[model samples]
Target: MAKGKDVRVRVILECTSCVRNNVNKKSTGISRYITQKNRHNTSSRLELKKFCPYCHRHTIHREIKK
Candidate 1:
């Protein structure tokens, strides 16, 4: 018989404004909100580099990687 406990998770949200220059603040805000909601099942944290077509810049976003 094997027994184990459930593992908790966490998520980190970042901005993706390093490409163009439109107005990704709203998008970033939304992303953060979403991440917050799913910050209870993340196994590993992975930083993702996303280039916003509207911002035309290289930004960062974190997520679970396992």
Candidate 2:
């Protein structure tokens, strides 16, 4: 038996607006979403437009390290 590389990996995406706003003011919480991505195809960080409850608008969410 041999070990194989993981094709799909779980990723966490956080709201960009919330992250920048948090520096100036205190926020209740930042919007976060869990999703899966193909490592071989998406070598760079994943970003998507998502709704943020805190910001109350669709913003760009970037992948963060675990």
Candidate 3:
């Protein structure tokens, strides 16, 4: 198996507003962003403020289970 330390991991950040407001009810998915983080540097779940195309605004995006 590969070493887990100091490895870059892939994660998805989803828009908070869109989820809370229930925007895009017709769609079967929520707005999400793909990004990577250093496992050693930041072990905690990553949260970022990013623009959501569906919501058309900047919102706090929290990492979701892959």
Candidate 4:
């Protein structure tokens, strides 16, 4: 028997606002989050609303390549 691929995979989510406007930012970094998702369940990219320290508020964080 062979091992199969994992259904749950780790993904990196980044702040959309930070990536869009990177120049002259209040913070020198972009907000990111690590989370696991089921590939079989949702094929599309993941989008989550998370708190961003730099943005100083909650923003829509979209999944990005690691």
Candidate 5:
């Protein structure tokens, strides 16, 4: 076993609803969360269920490119 170059990488999670509902004026400036993931243990993109202040509900937050 060995550690990869990107052992820990910074990632951003954005609200799925906010991105889809762009027409909504309130959806402006989508909510996002910053986090770090283990590249070796979990190389795949991470999707987390988090609360969105604008949406005011738990939404699927998917990892996005920096």
Candidate 6:
């Protein structure tokens, strides 16, 4: 068995308040909330929210690659 370097996991958080607010604002709405700066550093090992395929929802946890 061997470890793969190319494989990586990402966490994506979905805030309900933010999502609703953005939807209401229309033009300047989306940009006002979400930002590229919020994205997690791939190299960091911090727990975060990610889209889960099994649960069909976003989950907050640490991602591991086998």
lDDT of 6 by residue, 1-66 (tens): 444433443333343333455556632322111112222345554455555443345655442332
Off by over 4 Å in 6: 1-45, 63-66
Candidates 3 and 6 compared: the better one by lDDT is: 3
Q: Candidate 1, residues 10-60: lDDT per residue as tens digits? A: 455544342122254334232321243333454456566765443455567
Instruction: Report the lDDT of model 1 for residue 8.
Output: 36
lDDT of candidate 4 over 1-66, digit per residue (tens):
433588888999999988877875656789999999999998999999999988899999999987
Among residues 3 or more apart in sequence or in different chains, the pairs in candidate 3 whose N, CA or C atoms overlap within 3 Å are none
Ranking by lDDT: 2, 4, 5, 3, 1, 6
| Candidate 1 Cα outliers beyond 4 Å, as residue runs | 1-43, 64-66
lDDT of 1 at 65: 32
CA RMSD of all predictions: 8.3, 2.0, 2.7, 2.1, 3.4, 12.2
TM, every model: 0.30, 0.88, 0.78, 0.86, 0.84, 0.27
lDDT of each: 0.43, 0.92, 0.82, 0.90, 0.88, 0.39
Pairs that collide, model 5? none
Off by over 4 Å in 2: 1-4
Clashing pairs in 6: 12-49
lDDT of 5 by residue, 1-66 (tens): 554465788899999999988666667579899999988888898999999998889999999998
Pairs with steric clashes in candidate 2? none
Which candidate should be chosen as best, given TM-score against the real structure? 2
Backbone collision tally, model 1: 11
**lDDT winner, 4 or 5:** 4
What TM-score, to 2 decimals, does candidate 2 have?
0.88
